[model samples]
Target chain A: MNTLSYGLLSLLSHSPLSGYDLTLRIQPFWPAKHSQIYPLLSQMEKDEQVTFETVAQSDKPDKKVYSITDKGIDSLREWLSEPASAPVLRDELMLKAYCVPLVDPSITRDLFQSRLEYYRNNLQRYEEKIRKIKETSDLDEGEVPAYRDPLFGAYILLNKALMSCRTNIEWCEWVLSAIPQDHT
Target chain B: MNTLSYGLLSLLSHSPLSGYDLTLRIQPFWPAKHSQIYPLLSQMEKDEQVTFETVAQSDKPDKKVYSITDKGIDSLREWLSEPASAPVLRDELMLKAYCVPLVDPSITRDLFQSRLEYYRNNLQRYEEKIRKIKETSDLDEGEVPAYRDPLFGAYILLNKALMSCRTNIEWCEWVLSAIPQDHT
Candidate 1:
């Protein structure tokens, strides 16, 4: 889903928005670096999907507020209507684990153990975030926001995804302990 | 996860086998064609992670069987004991879909719809395969095979994956319906 491009169009459809506003709106799902942002923006302008107007700001430099063109609207509408392909799953770490017999034993062991720790830390962080979010003010976007909180379904997915991560961590531990180890 | 490569090495650790046998065992999770397979095999050989010997056969052409080296075993054992890395996801179709606003509207629509249809067909095929395999007399071997009978946990995952596909399909339809007819 040319996600970034789609995002630009989506935001513009609602209202003309600055790059900063678009960045914030898109961040929850479509992550983008400023580096990726500028190039794609330039590309979209060249393609006539979007045009920018200089907006005077009270502070800081003049901002470029982007609006979607008719062509852009047609494109996103077309995309939104289309079915997505099956997601491609590619985990290079799993592949490397499969080839563990080929590399240095200690290096592999160290790497795996480090990953285990990392996963633990990751789980901790997510737990903290989810807990904080759940405990804090209501998911109701003050009863009437332009967009409904994506969290309704997003949290459900987070549960499943988190469960999967925990399973992966357990699996990692299981494989580590069960496998016979002989340094010599 | 470099899963195929890692699996190939561990599989070799068990005993030397040809690419055909390896592919057959590996496909349930790590499906790879000759193009993807042979190239990686060549690279592993170059790295001395695997050793291969060509053997003559009576009723068939000669076969090249591969085996894991002692160093490979050490590496595998070490890797299993360590923690794994954070998984990174890369979905090309999603990326393309996200950027659809930059492409020609009709072209984007066609591509998106094609992908949707492809996913739907895959869902059907997986469902059928599950049913047929259940009706069959015997189950095969490997990690996924162990869960073949009477809707195992692995089967549950396949089902879950299927559900996700169906959900995505609905999302696509919703997106389609939301768009104006002129875009169509």
Candidate 2:
């Protein structure tokens, strides 16, 4: 199975979740569309890696809630033992940044300004998330969940996200400061 | 045309390059295979966004060195004016990080250890690159290249890479410290 398939199983290992819930939860880590996820979930069900139950909603149509099976856990363990592939980052901004000399100074300023705002928004979201996790999980100030705790993974991942967001913000601000102001 | 198409043009805007050179140069910002790049280069050529000349090599086979056309510069300028799309990051380590509890403590330790090494290696490479840029560009300590300078893009991009690498290295070390040592 592909990495995304295993990623789905990884989320299910925490707790059973509907496809919609899985889609939302996986966004910060691995971004997958509903179109890609639904087909993979079906294939995973056939492979016995995951099983789903049809839950009927009163106001909405029925949905498939999936959970990881023993086979899935075994697979995840095996996958974890192997070396993870290198990360792939495709950012349109980097491409644009390379050609910034072709555009006006005002345009360059606007580009970095908007990106800085985006990272600021993300930083706030991550901070709020970590605070909520601490409140709900009863983690004390500067305390981390135990390695075996289900919240441990989420905790570290959120910290990573926060760190990355802050770094991006710093970079964008640096770029903006470096840009020459237009006198016209 | 796709974002990758624009990305190829962005690199070519600086100077003429072969498909092989483009593939190598784009790796830090956007990872693409030669197979994916070759066909796109041909398509870009067909669309008149780029032109190429046959460059004969002493020992190696002749290669097509591509240069961005006026059409390509117009495309890149238009693209820079618009807001860039959100970055897409698909990291397998992140997926594995979420399910760390399923594996043994030793396995988790190895996972982060290897990833830490990967980031450290990248950090060194980026440091060396920035040093060379400074040496060749004749910039003083803490002096950044001018916005109109060709080295400007590479300088800022390297700084971003250095920042990101250091952040990842920090995160990996933190994760490693959080892991409990196995005492059998």
- The RMSD of every model to the true structure, in order and in angstroms, is 8.5, 1.4
- On lDDT, the leading prediction is 2
Shift in Å, residue B22, candidate 2: 0.8
How does chain B of model 2 score on TM-score? 0.97
| DockQ for candidate 2, C-alpha atoms | 0.78
Error of 1 at B167 (Å): 14
Runs of candidate 1 with Cα error greater than 4 angstroms are A1-38, A51-70, A92-117, A120-160, A166-184, B1-7, B20-33, B55-63, B74-83, B91-184
RMSD of 2: 1.4
How much is the lDDT of residue B174 in candidate 1? 42
TM-score of chain A for the candidates in order shown: 0.60, 0.96
The lowest-lDDT stretch of 10 consecutive residues in candidate 2 chain B is B175-184
lDDT of 1 by residue, A84-169 (tens): 54454544455455445444446555666776787788678667766665666344532211112323223433443455457657
lDDT of 1: 0.59
Kindly report the docking quality category of candidate 1. Answer: incorrect
